[model samples]
Target: MKIYKILNNNAVVVKEHDEEKIVMGSGIAFQKKKNDIINRQKVEKIFVMNEGNEKFQELLKTLPEEHIQIAEDIITYAEGYLQVPLSNHIHISLTDHLSFAIERHQQGFQINNKLLTEIKALYKKEFEIGKWAVQYVAEKLKVQLPVDEAGHIALHIHTAKLGSGDIASTLQQTTIISEMIEIIHQELGMDLDEESISYQRLLTHLRFALTRIESNEPFQVMDPDMLEIIQTKYAKAYTIAVKVADYLEKEYDIQLPSSEMGYISLHIQRLIT
Candidate 1:
């Protein structure tokens, strides 16, 4: 790949096979000029132009080298753990978030995540990785970040896992799932085992349900016979599902069709048993 432009001593815009890529590493672009062939050995990370050149360039201009490196490390670890490729936008969003977080910590300003509990409850694995990230960032950046910041980082990973660029919607989904879980717990008069397979299944169900709700997809129609059987057999679970449906209707203005109720009640029955 040949250098198309140099962003800094450690970063450069390169072109390979007629496609633009932003490469970064320690001294990767030092003394390099446009049209110079890049030394692949110095490259630490390569960001494809999956989002857009303009947005990538803007990030390259303002994001510090350390911040970018930290984001890259986090993304690498998350991808391995998730067993899925994350969206390229995480490169930008995570870096920006880390940069701002570091700045806030330095300025003695701490922002609390109002959805911290919800995020932790809904995204357990990601939240654990986020906590690890907190320690990693602290050791590397020599600054202490609050536990709430871990929740924020978890949300970023959650957003990447969903492949959705809208952080707001991702957060809303988290909130919705957490609220539903709380409702189930309250109605059942018990604390849920977060590590239980049934709980995990419930979370997966809510995750996709929120996706459908957000995308305005119509729910599948259920057979009256099956719906009646489910409602009669798992009356308690079906009642809890109704509460969840009512919450969704009031909060997001999305109705849960009978099929949704059946699925939710089935998951609830599994959890209750």
Candidate 2:
């Protein structure tokens, strides 16, 4: 592909099939001008723009080559580990976060993540990946990143996985899920078996419930006979579900309709049994 624009000595914008793509490698654009044919052997990474190229071009201008390269490596590793395709925008977000994180660390300013505990509990796999990324960044940059930064990185990964790109909302959902799990533990007087199918089912149910709550969507009302039967059959679980609803109402100002309560009670019952 011929270079359409040069981002730097190591990076260039190329057009293929009438689409713009950012290509990068060591000295890929050295002494190259627009319309020059690119040497494919030197290219290490290619970023296909999903929204617009302007933001990426801006990022390339300000971020160092090492930071960008590290971000790309982390994203690639995360995709392989998670076995899911991350949103293309992760390249932009991760690079920007790393750049800021490095600057803050250099200037002796450390940022704390208030949701660190919740992030670790709710997003176990992603948080583990984030910790690995932190170590990777530290070794590569020769600067130690604070543990809290792992939580921040996990949030970015979670947001990308959700494809929502809303960090605040993703964090809220995590906090909610964590709180629910805590309630379950407290009410059941035992730790959950994380590897069990029941726990996975409950976790999935809670995730979707949080999504609906965030969207202000109420669950469909259940038939009175069925609701009564569920409430009576799973009395303890129903009570726990009520406690969860109370927590949601008090903490998030979200009301759990009776319809939602019935399904949540079922999931809780499955966990206990």
Candidate 3:
């Protein structure tokens, strides 16, 4: 890799195998240089930058548009119903909330009413950004995201609502597990065997799953095909977790992706195993 243009000391424009790409860093890689060849191994962290290039721009442009619109909708909905902002109520930070909202739209789910009504009512500025975020995802990913999937996805993407202020590779899996635990805990009401090492291990795995999502790291649990393991070993937990997810979707007016939910349910099963 060669330094095409030193964007900053920590960052530079380097082509990957003769391909044009955008890169970012904390500082400029070169003081005054263009077309300075560099090694891929030498570069620290490189990312694909979206510069609104015509061809690629066409894809992501709509995403921001949709994001802003969605935010507006959320704001309006909240003001009309809950009279508060979802962020204020949940203490959900803004960055993660927007990220997850875009992702959920990418995966094809709709935002729901419960928090939607509140978000719109309180955080008008954040809601504006949220709407823009929806559009950004739409255009950037070239995925015409639906509005319904915006709210929960936004919540999941927002580290504020989930736990941290960032997303992990295991985010989808983490959301499922977190929601499952909340549901089951509500029902069982501290009945889980706290003294049992098995219970502790299960909680550990669940936490790990969430960390993965926040770090954008691959999920370690389902690295192998463990769905069967869940089904065979902890059938009750798996069944209960999934059922609770479905019930929440209906009762609370939130969207829960089944595939993501199942991943968490599988981890919950590990608790009993």
Candidate 4:
């Protein structure tokens, strides 16, 4: 595609099928001008400038070329390591975050990550990638970012992996899951073994349940007889599930249907028993 505008030596805005796209590569635009044809083989990343993503375009234009390169490199590594195609919005979100984070670090600002422990426990793979990302930035940019920054970066990666592009919703989901586990511990009066299989199962169930709740998707209808049997068999577990559900509703204004609660109760039963 021909260059519509040059972002830097490594990136340029190009038009294809009448849609604007930001294409990046090593020296892709060196000695090039507008209307120059891009070398397809040299192109490493292509971001479609879709509607409602004007900020992405502006960021591409305004952020330092090196910062954008770092974001692209991290995104490439994350996608390969996680084996998931992250939402393209990560290009905008991560680039913006990295630029701001580097600036903050340079200016003697320390942003504390309150959810560091929870993030490490809940998002193991993403957190691993986040750790790698901070190290990568350090080696390239000569900056010593705090470990808490990895937690913050992991949340961004998790949001992109969900393909939601809503970091607030992802953060809320993480907080809810962490708190829900605490509710189970309090209501059932047992300390959970975070490394145990049952605990992992419980965590996975909570994650999917929140996804369904947020998407307004109903859980599969449990038969009334089976539901009643399980509730009766695991009365305490079911009660804790309801309490967790209530917490979600009251604290975040997120309503969890009874069917989802029933599913959560089964997971809770596994943990308690």
Candidate 5:
């Protein structure tokens, strides 16, 4: 492969079989110019540049080569740990996030991930990878990042695992769930134990509820008789569920089905009683 563009001393864009590819290695592009043939022996990794990836191309040009390498290494670890192929956009999104995170840390800034507890409770596997990544970065860059940063990284890993490349949606879902949990606490007037089975069940229900709404997948429709029975028997829980439904509709423009509310009310009743 011949060099089409040099991103840095260790990375370059090469042309192979009429396709652009990113090639990276130590000193791979040293003293090399455009059109120079890459030393095949020195090549370590070859990435087929995705078409219409202008953002990734620009990221390669501007981000420090070491940061990109760290991002790639962390991604490789995450994939191996999960035993799944992540979305290609994780290359762009994770690298961008990692870069910004490191820069902020160096400038003595801290970002608190408010969803840390929810993330750790919900995304255990991804959060484990995030903890490892924080230790890895601390060793590599000598920067001790806060555990909150691990939660942020876990969200990135989870977003990649989902193959959606939509971090905003993932964060929004986590945020909505957290808020809904708070609503339950305030409505029921109790400090719900996070480690309890009831709390876990509630989290699972809310997670699936959000997933159902987002995908527009229908759940088992409740009959009017059962719905009425639940509404009458668990009046407070049903009312809280209705408030949650209204909040979702008003804040996120997501209209939860009546059947879904019925299910949510059952879960809330279990939690409260």
Candidate 6:
């Protein structure tokens, strides 16, 4: 592996002779400008780097059609998800996931079922995201994940975690729920009962959960046993409000907003719990 360009001290760009692919790595620094000598110790991971430049074009030649296409899909999908435009930061996570998807496909790994019904229910938009990713991979690596295949993979990524890993650690219960509950209690004053306030907060939390679940973000319910009890106790409101998240997931395909999900889930908690 030869040093090509250093992104920063934490990252570097290099070319690998054996694989003949352009790669990027972390914990590396460039000694010179664009064209400079790179120290071997600085190299982290030697593979292809994404940039809409000559380097990207050169790197493409070394990749198979499938890989190239998958890479492209990863790029487009990432841009939308991250809300980041294409630049020197080709998004390490996105590229890594694409490579994983492509390799798994090549090696004949089965696609795991994660959010199948949810994604298929919101088929149009989800498929649009999937199509963009599939086309990008096809064009870049000349490989394509079937619509359903890509759908499963994409949903898997969204639902996973907050970080780069496959299992995303959803942020836990925040004081916000309790605080909001207090606020509502105070706002309702002597006119409303304490139980009513609790119910409101429970619904709120469920609404919040809806958003998180839809976005593949991590969310926490108040308590499981308590929630189930409420579901049995307050069957009517519980059933109606419970449908809020289901309706959104099935109808719009997009998750409810955080605030909305919180309110909804909170209400559900008050009822069943």
Output the lDDT of residue 252, model 2: 83
Misplaced by over 4 Å in model 6 are: 1-73, 76-90, 119-127, 136-144, 152-167, 170-207, 210-273
lDDT of each: 0.85, 0.85, 0.48, 0.85, 0.87, 0.47
Which structure is stronger by lDDT: 2 or 6?
2
Which of 1 and 5 is ahead in lDDT? 5
- Over the stretch 177-199, how does candidate 6's per-residue lDDT look in tens digits? 33333443443343333335555
- Looking at model 5, residue 220 earns an lDDT score of 78
In model 2, which regions exceed 4 Å deviation? 162-165, 178-205, 212-243, 250-253, 259-273
Error of 6 at 140 (Å): 5.8
**Superposed Cα deviation of residue 73, candidate 4 (Å):** 0.6
| Candidate 4, superposed: residue stretches over 4 Å from native | 16-18, 35-41, 52-54, 162-165, 185-191, 220-239, 253-273
Q: Give the per-residue lDDT of model 1 (tens digit) for 8-64.
A: 778889877878888888888878798888888898888786656667678777877
Model 4 agreement with the true structure over 1-273: per-residue lDDT tens digits: 899988788888888788888888999999999998889999988877576357886786788888888888999999999999998788888999989998999999987887776788778888998899999999999998888989988988988986554899878877888888888888878788877888887888888888877677878888889889878998888888889888988998878777778888998888877
lDDT of 3 by residue, 159-223 (tens): 33334344343344444554555676665445666446555555555555445544677643343
RMSD of 4: 3.4
Per-model TM-score on C-alpha atoms? 0.79, 0.75, 0.29, 0.79, 0.89, 0.37
Q: How many residue pairs clash in each candidate?
A: 0, 0, 70, 0, 0, 55
Instruction: Report the alpha-carbon TM-score of model 3 versus the true structure.
Output: 0.29
lDDT of 6: 0.47
Clash count for candidate 2 is 0
Q: Per-residue CA lDDT of candidate 5, range 54-123, in tens?
A: 6777887899888888888889999999999887778888899999999999999987989988898888
